[model samples]
Structures are given as structure tokens and as C-alpha cells.
Target: MSTPPASAGTGIAASRWRHLPVGALETVRGNLEDALLAGLLALPVTFAAAVLGGLVGEELMEPSGPATTLDLTSRASLAAVAVLAVLGVLARGLVIALRGVLMARALAAAVRAGTPPTEVPAPLQWQHAHERSDRAYRRTAIILLVILGLCFGVVVPAAVQEPFLSGLAIIVAGAAVLGLIALGIPLTGTVLRRRQLALLGPVDGHWTQAHRIIAAGHVLTGDAVAAARAGRPERGHPGSAARRLGKVATAVVGVGATAAYLGFQVVAALAFPDRQRWAGGLPGERADLGPEAERMVDLAVTVCVVGGAVAILALVVGALAGLAERTQEQAALRRALVEGAAPPPYPVLQRYLRRRSAPLLRMVSALVGVMLVVGGTLVVLDGVVDAPSWGSFAGAGQGLREATGLGPGILGLALGVAALEVALASLLEARERRLRDAVVQRWPVRPAPGG
Candidate 1:
């Protein structure tokens, strides 16, 4: 074999090194943007929860006493709820609209980059896949509805008075439902694959419309990355100014609501409750304010806590979305390099390898770190501080039990569940890496001179 020129080899190596950092930085920036967007989208949920908490707080502090039914007849309460509801709905709508705008921009960028159209499977095969997907969805929905009805409508209502029992029931039911869904996913995928193979003949490997769509998405994403790196500006659509204004307005509402919620929590904790009423008594045991005041306080605190939990969940989802995006990019680059097809830019390839080697390990490590930090913090706080009867932390456990029937045991259960998830994810990640390595090794690399 003839040796390539030294200059050519040097040029290739230089090109590979030149944009590697830029590409990786771009990937990280994209992930952060995705996470922030996801968190923004969840603001409405948090706002709604805050509003509910506020209403509950008002009822607790009401002069007439807590009503069995919400007093929607009260003008002040009704107006406040209505206003908050409208704001939440508007915020949600704007977020969705902004998402659409971003998607349009992405599509335009993909088109400008000359990304190829997605491949379409044969009509019969497509139809079969569609039918199978629909059937699976419907079946899953029905099972979910049945399980929810049994748990919430029957079991939960029966144990409503017993907070611990009801909370445990909810947790158990939720876990079982999640496990069922998880198991069903793989079984469904297997069935779909077998059916496809039977129809397309065993010689034809697994291919489906979903796979085609995913492949197309990867291509578009790759093109977008390339265009971004090349400094090509994405053309704005008509009404861009209006969309920008809408986004601004929505953001204002979301931020204002979130701040207001936090303020309420602070004020309610420090100034609202009468600490003297419950002095020398266990939290929620004294009826100094009213018979139902302590109960209402617990309910309000529970709602706020739940809202905080939801916010955290939203951020987690955003992080996952970013991870998924990076994974797709890595896969696209790997396949291209291995197949000797149109390989991505050298920088992108370098970026992929830099990311791919240790994502799962990093994720697992992060999870463990978080677990340790949280556990240690809780242990330290429990030992160092004696909780006041009227303090914010006071009656928190009772509040949780009142609201969800969950006791302190729920904390341990949550940690256990998280640990299990980390373990499972690590195993799956390892298996995936092994499979990808096998494929890469099997195929001879065909280097493309340029991206």
C-alpha cells in the first residue's frame, strides 16, 4: 500500500484537534439549554401547585374555620384562584408555542444543511408497525386506568383516614405499575421485532417506521450541529418578534409565580403561624388556633413540598433529554465512521469518543454523590438541631402522612428506588457499550478526508 504524504497526515491530525473542543463545548451548551427549557416548561405545574397551597393556607387561616368543601363562594378566594389558573394556563401555552418555534427553527436549519429525507419502509410493513404500536398503546392505557382506579378510587379512599397505610398503598401501587410498564416495553418490542421479521422474511433484519424516524432525527441533529459550527445563522420565520415577546411575557409570569410561591412559603413559615399556641406541645397536637388549623397547616406544607418535588423531577427530565440527544449524536457518528458512509466532521467524532466512553459511569457517580450528600445533610441536621414545634420543619412528617399517607419510611424507600434505578441503568449502559464496540470492531473504518 502506498503511504499517504506526511503533510496530509499532519493536516488530518491538526484538523481533528482543532475543532474538538469547540464541538464538545457546543454539545455541553446544547445540553444545558435543553435542561433549562424543560425546567421552564415545568414552571406552570409548580405555579399551579403553589396556588393550591396558597388556597389551602388561606382556608387554614380562615376565621370561619376550614370548610369540608372549598368555599369557592368567597369572592377573594375565587378571584385569586381564577387569576392564578389563567396565568398558569397562559404560561403553559406560551411555553408550548416557544417549543414549536424552536422546532421550526431546527427544521429550517436541517433543510438549509441539505439533510436527506428519512427513508420510508414498505407500505405494508409501515401499516403493520403502526397497528402494533396503536394496539400496544391502547392496551397499556387500559391497564393503567384500571390500576389507577383500583388504587386511588377504591384502596386509597378506604385507607384515607390512615395516612401511613394510604401512603404506603400509593407507593406500592405506583411501584407495581411502573414495573409492569417497564417489563411490558421490552416484551412489546420483542413481539414487534418478531412480527416484522416474519413479514419481511428472516433474512431481513429488524427495521420499523420508528427506527426510520429516529434515524432521520439523528441526521437532522447532526446537520444542525454542523451548520452551527460553520457559523451559519438560522433564518427566523415570520412573526419572530411576536414570538419573542410572547416568550418574554411567559417567562415573566413563570418567574413571578415561582418567586411569589417561595415568598409565601417563607412568610408562612416565619410569620403566619402562631408559635406560642403550640408552645411545649408536639407539632400539630395543639388546637390553639382552631381545631382544624393544624390539619390545614399540614396540608399546605405537604402541597408545597410536593410542588418542590415536581420541580426537581422536571429538571431531571430535562437532563435526561440532553443525555438522549448526546447519545443519538454519538450513535450517528459511530455508525458513519464504521460503515465508511458519510462520516461526520473530525471534531464531532472526537467529541463523540470523549463523551461516549464514560457517560454512564459519570451518571452513576453523580447519583451516588447526590445520595451521600443528601443522606449526610439529613443526618447532620437531625443531630444538630432540635426542631421547634411551630417551625417550618415542625409537623412536616405529619403533613406528609396527612397528604399522602406516607411516613418517614417513604424517604428510605425513595433512596432505595433511586439506587435500584442507578444499578439497572448502569447494567443497560454497559450492555449497550459492549454491543456498539462489537459492531465497530466488525466493520472496517473508511476515513473520509473532509466532513
Candidate 2:
């Protein structure tokens, strides 16, 4: 092993990174400062929304009786929710902006000193996505703050504890809805003030798009490599037409997967709480039926839930695999022609790994959805069904109990279906990879000098 570098040299190098201290305390402090900045950017927007909401609202401060319930669910409350939603969007953008400043500055420093720029995962670098840590913390914090304010302060004092759940749910749901809008506002904010980077692809980060990258690569390659894209036919070819078909097919699968999952849920909603009675009335009322009848009811619910889950998983996996293939194909083409790099190998494990991640995320979202459904079911049942608490039995060990109870068996089936989706996703991924590799192997990046 080599000897360690001297302490004096280490100190000299460390001087630069001292700005972003590599310690736990530093992280806490950074988050605090970042959160503060994010809050300031969001608070004004939220306060304005609150003001607007109050204007149209029936009464900002009032005790609710039976008669006032309809008025409480008034237009003003909706307006206030809208305002909080906008504030959440601003806060998310601010968090990203702060982090981007830190990252860009760090890169600029290294570049000035003749060093490599700081690099991170492409997903984190994605300008539009909201799932990244930098964005999530900011987003969740803003929503949490709004919920606390309205629920604890306004709603509770007014003797309407319902606002706590209603506000929290509203914020969560609003954040999800605004995610798409937040992405677009950064593009060209006229009414929306954009203090963040444009919500485009990674091409915006290093300053410029694909064509510029192409020009730079050709120059760097000494004119040896020419550019080609997934679409737009190459100078000479029948194969180009064929390639478009594959690209189009990949896109179609993505759309289809999204559609199938939606359709399945709509159909499942029709099945109801039990075959005997449709939901919407007194759902929780206990039936005077025998144990055998309950058992049958449980079995039916499990079947539908599991079966629907399977369909969702298959569609999701298939869709993602298709997307991954198209992305990799375009990237490979770029690198092969522009940078003169050989196409990378697409081992089965890689495809499997890529597909497995999606199922995991889907599992997380599904877990949350299931918890809400189960908990809410239990709550509603307390009022009507007169059965054992379903929400009490959840988690890994509780799985079998849930199946026995019939409430959880549906979830299990869903999970089983998800597994099938993973398998299908893997298969589709492998096929897509092969298609790209075949095309890459045949396509000549550089033609011999004079034909």
C-alpha cells in the first residue's frame, strides 16, 4: 500500500471543501439554512393563498354547527388549498435551486483549478423530477408546515379537528397534482416567478442541447464521428424505417401500461365490499351470516385484489422496460458515433436490476395506498360493518392473519401479480437490449474515406 499524503498537503486541499464541511453537524446546519431559504420563498406565496382563501371563505374564524357544515366546505376553503399548493411548488423549486447553486459552484471551482467537475447520478441531475431528496424534503416540509398551521391553529381553534386529516390529505394530494405543473412553470415562467433552473433535460445543465453536444464531440473527435438520432432517417437506408417501428412500439407499450393500470382500478371499484351488498350506505353493518359466509366474502376480496395487482405489475414492468430500452438505445447511438465508444454490454443481470427497481417503488406506493385503504376501511367499518379491526393486522407477520381475515389476501395477490410484472419486465428489457445491440453492431459510425 502507498503511504498517506502529508497532513500539510491535506489541509491545503481541504481548504476548498471546508465550505461544504464533511460532517454530520454540517449536514444539519446546511439543511436548516436550506430549509429556511426554502421556507421564505414559500411562506409569502402560502400567506397570499391563505388571504385569498379567507376572502372568499364563509368565515375565517367561526364555530361549526350542523347548519354550517356545508358552508365550511366552501369555495374559500378550496381557494386556500389552491394557495397552499402553489406555495408547496415554490418551496420545492427553491430547494432544488439552492442545491443546484451548491453543485454548480463546486463544479466551477474544480474546473477553474483544472480538475474534474463534481458528478452525480443522472436521476438526481434530472431537472423535472420531484422524487429526488433535494426536492422531496423541501416539498414534504412545506406541506407539513401548511398542514400544521391550518390543522392545529385555524381548524382546531375553530373546533373543526376534521381539518387535520382534511388539510394533510389535501396538501399531499395537491402536491402530487402540482408536480406536473411545477415541472412546466420553470420552463418559461411569466405569471409564475422562476428562481430555479429550467425544467428541461440534462442537456440544459452543462449549457446547451443535443446538437451542441454533437458539434463539440465531432470537433473533439477530429471529424471522425458523425451524429445520428433514434428518429429522423439516416442519409441512406431502408433499415432506418424499420428502426422507427421499434421506437414507436416502445412508446406504445409505455402508454398501454399506464392505461391498463388505470382501467383495472376502475373495474375493481365495481366489485364492492361484498357480493351480497353494494357499498355507499351503512358499509360496516355486521351480517348475521355464519362463519362460512364471512370466509367466502374474504376469499372473493382477496382474489380480486391480488388479480388486479398482477395486472398492474405486468403493465408497469413492461412499460418501464420499453422505456429503458429506448433511452439506452439513443444513448448508445450517441456515444458510438459521437464519442467513438463501443456499445456497452447488456447482460441479463443489468436488465433485471433495472426492472427490479421499478417494482420496489411501485411496492412502496402500493404499500401506502393499501395502508390508507385498510385503515380507512377499518374506520368506516367501526361505524357500519361490526367486524374485527382490519387495520390492526398489517406488516410482514400480519400478512397471514390478513389472508385469514380476507382483508389482506387481496394485497398478497396484488404482490404476487407484481412479481409476474417483474418477470415480464425483465423479458421485455432483454429483448429491447438485443434489438439495440443488433442495430448498433450493424451501424457504421464512420465510413471509410472515399467509399
Candidate 3:
């Protein structure tokens, strides 16, 4: 081996990083701070929703019941709901923390294996794959947040005792707040990604050196590389219009189903015998109704069932399409890397790492599907079975119990799904980072520092 360079401090600097924690704590702290900021921004909207719910419940539903029963049921239901919410938050946090821990451990192992540290990007020199699917990811996230927020704002108030005008006002206000939040999410994510990439730094050398360095670092598992090798990347074709159209059908169906449901609600409200009656309503009980009212309710029940089914179907299909897209992207990246530089010939003994979060996406989808189905079933049963009024706290509690028992809490499922999507996005980001480092290392050309 050649003698070490003079100025020997460089050796010490490298050795220090060899034992470093690889910025795991920094990553978690940054993520938590971003999450806190997001929560703070959303706090006002959540508080407003809770206040409005309590006000409407006390004014209308409570007055219809014995005070003691109402108080007991309300408190019991709220407590149960709070407990479930806390559990869900804890579960999600645990998942994220565990993932970070594992990554840190792997990185530490890489350091111990003698992987050399790359030069970090100066603050102004940083560049990442923001131009890639990240833009689309952010946009889609924002759109989904806006759509769901509007739906909840409109639907929840209508479900309670809020007047039509009051519900409309809530929807407008919620949309405005969520719009700001939508913008914030992606910006925060971009900053975090940039910081992480800067810390990881760029590997620099020839293509062969790049490959060796990555292998030494263990940035990707062997199975991922092997799978990429076995799979053929999808190629664009002149006659692929039909396939492209098919891919988008899921989103279209989801949008259509949601629109149909909203339309049905509007039509039923307009056609009702007295619109004002809904403003102060009991869930299962109605005044002596004529045949027309009965028929309208039946029609609504039918629409809800069909619409919910379609929406769930759409989400399932969309999720599958997403997986396919990821697979294709991985194939393409793998092909590019292999063509540029060959990996080690010897087989690795490490167990294959399956994408754990992949199955979670399906689970969340199922939970959401079940929630929709249960809600539709309840409405249909109410229409056909002549049940007692469900507007009371006890009835509401019973409904909550049924819903929670059947599927995970709707809020929890939604949160889980969002987290999974974010995780998947991070995967794509990891791949991009590796590719960027490889390219820069091979070419020996760096982007000039700029803000």
C-alpha cells in the first residue's frame, strides 16, 4: 500500500466519520419538526371542527335525549375515540422510528466495512431529483388533501345538525386552510430531501469506482439489483395510447363516483318535502312521510351503495397501477446502472428485502373500502328497517363502535395510507440519489453551486 498523504489530519477526518451515526438523529429530528409544523397549521381547522360538532350536538341531538344518558354516551364515545386515535398515532410513529433505526444500523455497518465518505454539497451546490416524479407526487398529494378536506367539511356538517348555509361556510373555510397546508407539505418535503441528500454527499470517480463505492456502502440490497437484472424495462411504443388511457381509468372512476354521490345528495336535498327539516334532524327517525319521500330515500340508498362500490374499486385499481409504475421505474434504473458498470459476480448471502410498505397500502385500501361499505349499509338499513333515531349520543356511540370494530378507524387508515405513500415516494428518492451519485462520480463533472 502507498504511504498516507501528508497533512495527516485528512486521515483523522475520515476515521471520525467511519464511526459517525450517519445523521440518523438529524434526519428524525428534521422530520419531526416538519410534522410538528404541519400539525400546528392544521390545529385551527381541527379545533373548529370539534367546536362546531359539540355545539351542533348539544343544540339538537342532546335536547332530544335525557340529559344524563346524553352526557354519559357523549363522554364514553369521545373517550373511546380519543384512545383509538392515540393508538394509531403511536403505531405510525413506531413504524417510522423503526425504519430510521434500521437504516442507521445499515449505514453504520457500511462505515465499519470501510466505505469512504464522499464530499458533501455546499449549501449552494445542492441539486436533487426535484424535477422527477416529486413534482407530480406533491401535486397529487395536494389534490387528494383538497378533495378529501372538502368532502369531510361538507359531509360531516350535513351529517350533524348544521344548517345548509352553515355547512357551506365550513366547506369554504376548510378548503382555504387545507389549500395552504397542501402547499406547505411539498415545500417542507423538498427541504428535507435536499438536506438529506447534502448529508449523504456525492460519490466521485469513474463508473467502475462508482459501482465499487456503492457496493461498499451497501446503499441498495443485492436482491433489488438482482430483481432489476431479471426484469425487462418497459419500452414506449407508437400504439400505446390504449394502454395509457387504461392506466388513467381508475382515477377517472374515482372522480366520477365521488361526483355522482355528491350529485345524489344535492338532488335528494332539493327534492325533499321540507329542506329545513334536515337542518335539525334525527338520523333514523323521520316525520310521517308520504310514498314520494320513501321512494326518494330508497333511491338514495341504492345510489350510495353503487357509488361506494365504484369508488373502492377505483382506489384498488389505482394502487395496483402505482405498483406497476414503480416496478417499471426500477427496471429502467437497473438497466441503466448495469449497462454503465458491472456488479460483483459472486452471489450475496443476505436475505431478500421485500417492500414491507407495499402490503400496508393494500391493507389501508381494504380498511377504506370497508368503511365506505359499512356507511352505505347503515344508510340502506335505516331506509328499509324502520330503526329508532340514531341522532342521540347513544346511537352515535353504537354506530362508532360498529364502524371501528369492522375496520380500523377511518382516520387511522387514512393516516396509514398517507404514510405508506410517503414511504414509497422516499424509496423512489433513494434510487434517484444513488443514480445521481453514480453519474457524478463516473463523469467527474459537478453542477455549479447555486441557490
RMSDs, each prediction? 20.0, 17.7, 14.4
Off by over 4 Å in 1: 1-260, 266-303, 343-366, 378-451
For model 2, the local distance difference test gives: 0.36
Which is the leading candidate under lDDT? 3
Per-residue lDDT of model 3, residues 308-395, tens digit only: 5565565456656555544454454355445653331112111001121232334343453333333333333334232354344343
lDDT of 2 at 121: 15
Q: Output the TM-score of candidate 1.
A: 0.29
Kindly report which residue pairs in candidate 2 clash with one another: 284-384, 284-385, 285-384, 285-385, 306-413, 306-414, 310-417
In model 1, how large is the Cα lDDT of residue 266? Answer: 49
Evaluate all candidate structures by whole-model CA lDDT and list the values in order: 0.39, 0.36, 0.40
Ranked candidates, highest lDDT first: 3, 1, 2
Model 1: worst 10 consecutive residues (lDDT sum): 14-23
Count backbone clashes in candidate 1: 2
- Provide the TM-score for each candidate, comma-separated: 0.29, 0.30, 0.37
Please give the lDDT score at residue 27 for candidate 1. 31
Tell me the tens digit of each residue's lDDT in model 2 across 1-451.
1112111332222111101111222222233333333323333323323232322222222433322322322222333334434544454455443544344333333334443112111222222222232444445555655654554454333443456777667556555644544454443233112222233223244333442233223221212223223243343322233345545654654454444344433323332333334431332333454566544544443443344444445444544554454455455544443554432332321232121222233333334333323333323322322335433222213333333344345446534653454454444444443333333223312211220
Model 1 lDDT tens row, 93-120: 3333222223223333333454322322
Candidates arranged by TM-score, highest first: 3, 2, 1
Pairwise lDDT winner, candidates 2 and 3: 3
